[model samples]
Target: MSAKVPASPRFAYKGDRLKPLRAFCQTARLGSISRAAEALFLSQPAVTLQLQALEREFGARLLERSGRRISLTREGQELYELARPLVEGLDGLDGAFRERVRGLDAGELNVAAGSSTILYLLPKIVEAFRATHPEVRLTLHNVTGAGGLDLLRSDAVDLAVGSMLDVPADLSYEPVYRFEPMLITPRNHPLAQKAELELQDLSPYGLILPPQRLTTYRLVDLVFQQNRVPYTVALEVGGWEVIKQYVAMGLGISIVTSICLTEADRERLATRSLARYFPSRSYGVVVRKGKYLSPHARAFTELIRPALFEREDYYANGQSER
Candidate 1:
């Protein structure tokens, strides 16, 4: 006698039954029914049932399970490729429509930015964006430059702003601003009286440098190395704020991006321009290649474009004319 097969659940009609396409796509992409279930907020058995239903509908096994792991078959891979975008598009549409109905100006905007940009640039932009779109939810992930780049690559945030040492081939960058670096020292330091000082002249002072990996640190290093000027590094900190505090306490003099200095920083310490030429560091926006920008993201980018690009042009042309 043939073995009896287990009965599948009966639906009143195909139209009334929820299509398991979404669940099937999730499982195939994630490679685990449990993970798919957690992402979709469904029970593990329910996710399995959905996948089983999908396989039945297609008349072939979509996944092969071994122990606790899963892998898609060839046919499953093709089907998943076709279905993933459709399901993701549907999800995007639903979110867009709900946000629209709530209000044209309402929805969350997530931004990832480095600490220096957060201190110097982000507050003004955030205030302006909020004033214009008060109903919109805004979130910021504060990170170092490398951390922000990692977040962008991992799809953790919609946008990031910071100083990128080099633009990755997989990412796009737009210059937001460029500012020269300045030498910072304690208020009573002897170099404070000079309007500008050469790099060679400061070789004897203890330096508080950004960690060696940072773009700013590399830029400073290149200038000193090329000139064969040796300086003592007394401390290395990751963030500009920490570097500034250390300088204020007389730990060491440091070279910092001018944007990182504020009125208070100047009052508490002293800044002098470098007599030797060093390249200006650029602050900019970075986005993952081919990521779709929502309406709010587009608008925010537009609002910031002038501050990033046009103002610099204005300054450049004005200086030339003068």
Candidate 2:
């Protein structure tokens, strides 16, 4: 007789039909059998059996084992990518389907955003969302620009809000707010006295910049490169606030969004608009193409993009990809 299928407590719907796929996906995501088993509430042996069965069916090795650590092979990576959304759809069916029928009384919404956007732009809107949808759980994940896209693709976050100068083909971005880019210096600096400033004008002073991986840094690099301007980096820093703090102490000057500057900062720091030199920075909502937004998610999107969902009946019909 054939060996009996191991009992899987995590998903009980289809006997052992989906257990292998589930096991492989969890293992891929968590990067270890023990952790995947812990997450699924199953023994390590059971999870291993499920993975072995999956590998046998595919006739290809799925996981590259290294002691206790694990990684996906190329084939395994493709399969995991193909299988993840299916597994997530299965896991989130109740919430997604119930929101379809019951109309968003309770559900979870995960949003990813850059640090500054979360700190400055989202507080009031988040407050409104909390007051309006007390039953729904909303989480704001602090992710960088690239990390946000990864979260969206993995279904970890429902949507993201930030600026994007270059958007991927599989995603959509809607501009919400625009802010002028400004150059700031210590109150006593000479450039601060000028009403107009150009990229070449600030070339002399060392600039305090964010890490190169971030969009802001790239934009600055691109602009400088195009203008054939030579600038020195006084210091490398992260976050507008940190850069601002250093500039206040006369460590170096920095370019920051006008959104970051307040009247209080005006007294301590000298600011000149770089709108002529740098393009206006636009921040917005970003969502993955073709993913269905729950009613609660849609409602929050509407709060961000009032005109996009102004029809009042868009959610009544199913989501058509934007």
Q: Who wins the TM-score comparison?
A: 1
The stretch of ten residues in a row with the least summed lDDT in candidate 2 is: 313-322
lDDT of 1: 0.76
How does model 2 score by TM-score?
0.64
Q: What lDDT does each candidate get?
A: 0.76, 0.80
Candidate 1: residue 74 lDDT (0-100): 89
- What would the per-residue lDDT of candidate 1 be over residues 275-321, giving only the tens digit for each residue? 34677777778899999776777767767755544334322311211
The number of the candidate with the highest lDDT is 2
Off by over 4 Å in 2: 1-104, 305-322
Backbone clashes under 3 angstroms, per model: 1, 0
Across residues 1-322, which tens digit of lDDT does each residue of candidate 2 receive?
9999998444342376677788889999999999999999999999998887777767799899877789999999999999999999898999988775754455788999988888767776787788888888899999986788999998899899888888999998888767777788898887876655668988889999999887778888888898899988899988888898899899988887765665467567877767766887777889999998888888887676553233223211221111
TM-score, each model?
0.65, 0.64
